[model samples]
Target: MFTIEHDFDATVITLVDDPARHRQEDVTVNAFEDCVTLEQYDAQSDRVMRVTLSPAQVSDLAAALDLPEGVYKIGRKS
Candidate 1:
C-alpha cells in the first residue's frame, strides 16, 4: 500500500511503498499527469518518484479525492 509521509522538518511529501500491502494499478492515489515543466521524463521505471501540479489542477485533484458512503469507487478503469 501507499503511505504519504511528511518530513517534519521540511514538510515535503514522500510517498512510500509498504511491503505488506501493494496497491492495484487501476485506482492508484499516486497517479498524476506528465509534467509540463519538461516535455520528457528520464526515469525508465514505473514508479512516479515526484510530481508538480498547477494550482487549477490541484483544485480539481482535491475534489477527485475519495468520498464517504462508498461513493468513491476504486480499481475502476478511467
Candidate 2:
C-alpha cells in the first residue's frame, strides 16, 4: 500500500509493507522542486538510509526503467 501527501515544499509518498497493521516501516520518497529523495530503514545500521537524486538523474532513472539491456545516454531536449 501507499500514501501520498502534498506539503508546502515537497510531495511525500510512503510505501507500506502491510496495510492492515501499518506497523512495518517501509520506503518513503520525497520529491522537491529541485531534487528527489528516497529513504528506507537499514536493519544493519539500525538507522534510516537516504539517497538523493537531482532532476537530471531522476529523468535518466525514469528512462532507464523502460530501457532494454545495454548502456545508453540520456539527452536533454532543447
C-alpha RMSD of each candidate structure in angstroms: 10.5, 3.3
lDDT of 2: 0.92
* Candidate maximizing lDDT: 2
lDDT of 2 by residue, 1-78 (tens): 899999999999999887565466699999999999999998888999999999999999999999999999877886
Please report the TM-score between candidate 2 and the true structure: 0.83
lDDT of 1 by residue, 1-78 (tens): 334434433223333334447532321233234321212223466554434565456555556774444444234233
**What are the Cα lDDT values of the candidates?**
0.39, 0.92
Supply candidate 1's per-residue lDDT for 25. Answer: 30
For candidate 2, list the clashing residue pairs, or say none. none
C-alpha displacement of 59 in model 1, angstroms? 1.5
